[model samples]
Target: MRGGFARPVISLQHAPDLHSLRALLALLALVALSGCSLFREPPAPEPVEAPIAASEAEPAASEPEAASAPEAASEPAETPGAKPAPKKPRPPLIRRHKPAPPPPVAASAPPAPPPAPLVQTHTLERGTFRTLLDSEVRKPDGKVVGRAVDMVAGPGGKPQEVVVNLQGFMGVGDRKANFPWSAVHINTPAKTPAITLALTPAQLQTPERPKSGAPQPGSPEAGPTRLPMLDANVERANGAKVGRVVDVLLGGSADPLAVVLDVSGTLEKRRTIAADWSALHFVTKNNALEAQLEMSDQQIDASPAYANDLPVRAVSPAAPPATPAAPAAPAAPAVPAHGDQ
Candidate 1:
């Protein structure tokens, strides 16, 4: 075995331990530091001087107001290109209260016009009517033609026609005629007016009723004619009987002004108010016929105060019993005791 095995002789004396190597390396490093060292140390930067504060007397550059203020540690600095901060919102407004308005009023209507003052009416008796029946109707040439038996008035209350007892044997027969009121002259001043013929009596007769096939005078082919206002009874709206119209007063133009009302009753005074066209309205009730009045009895009583010859005598309390005249001074005793006879 000895012949084949050869062990290498190791140089243990020259090889270094770890601690010794460290010492050698440290020594070398010190040597390198003395010379130009492998990891060279940079020279310390030049001594930097602090910025100098400006003296009170020195003119200095202006700093912005925000930059001059002391920094707050809690707030962060703003960077370029950053979004802006949001604005505070405004408070809401308050409203005022107003009062409600009042209610509206209604408008009034205008009043109507009153009646005219120029008309009136009066009533008369049938006996007075008969007395004027036989009055003579003479012509303008002084020729006697007929006698008036009755009178007729239009609805307007003006005399329009008359019934005449024409010339016959001693005025005995019933021959009669109808004449327009304009064809006669009335002497109303004569206490009884004599109806004088201003035209021929024969010309004034009512048109004769024609044959069955003839043109009717009062038909639609002919014009309308006036109706009689005579004997039309008058009344109030409440069915109260007022009066009858006896005579009518005509104006200067021969237009009827008023009709004389015959208000014949126990306490009624015959009077006339202005009788306009409304006076022709009439009514009948319970066999009593009447012409309507536009007003009531109270209204009639309150018509304008009329003056006549009747004087208002103020009666006195009669003379206080005449005081008996002191018994005529006792007649002076006639001196009988003196025996002067």
Candidate 2:
């Protein structure tokens, strides 16, 4: 039989080695395991959308859907471009100072009785009362009577009566008039130092005991011979030197009224003060003239100051120089005028 179709036949260029067979098997295995997808490029994945914010994701109120659901309250939304505002810090707490309450008033003191009104009082001490003796004695009408001459002390060593000398013309014909101590008001004396006399000059002149320049047989003046203690150092009962005696002033009946003391203290300045004679005692130590004042230095300083250097001695003022008499006009200048020719 004749084959019309081409007989099935094969041809090889060369026999394959063992190494080449192994390589062909590995290549066939890789091709069978892998899918066709590996041959084509992988498809690009779809992009995932990010979650939107409540302010941006929601629709505005004007939308019909948004109007149906509970309307979202309208609030201003921060723009993406603007940053959020920083929070404000709280203010610090302030503490205030409180003032203390006023002090409580003392109840027991009756709210402190309105400060007692200041009061001033003066007392008539013995030393002050005696200074009146050296002063002048005058009538109630201020009529010039005379200067106090002496003071007569009673049993208590207190002045019971005083004597004044009536000053006549030119201090001449002066007479000592006896007056009752009770009749004189030493206080309320004038600045010139004058006493008020209860009796007139005539009544005082006609005093009992003596008449017409006569001395009684037995009188106090005749009893003891006492001399004045003038220019003497005066001390106090406390042994403090007060002053020195300047002069002695007399009252009626030849008794001492007061002694003018020129005080010399720490200052060494001299000022005269009249001390009561009744309070003074004649102290003769070593035969020197000195007096011991019973009063303190304060009392002596309070006495009236004497103006005259020698107050005890009375000197009449000299008559003023006779005024010159004017000479008569020059004989009328002689009417020697032309009419006289």
lDDT of 1 by residue, 1-341 (tens): 11222334535577578677667667765665555544466976754455556754643558422323332443344557987545345445444567767767667767776644332334321222212346777776666667665455543334567667657567654455666677655554433346666775456444555677865432211012333344545667776766565544433333444544555467756554434333454343454333456555555554432222222111111222335655555455555566565
Worst 10 residues of 2 by lDDT: 116-125
Candidate 1 stretches greater than 4 Å from native = 1-136, 144-159, 174-176, 186-194, 201-227, 237-239, 250-254, 266-292, 302-341
> Residue 109: error of model 2 in Å?
34
- Over the full model, what C-alpha lDDT does candidate 2 score relative to the true structure? 0.53
TM match of model 2 to true structure? 0.31
| lDDT tens digits by residue: candidate 2, 287-311 | 4423566655444544455544323
C-alpha lDDT of all candidate models, in order: 0.48, 0.53
TM-score of each: 0.35, 0.31
Q: How close to the true structure is residue 122 of candidate 1, measured as C-alpha lDDT?
A: 40
Judge candidate 2 at residue 179 and give its lDDT. 70
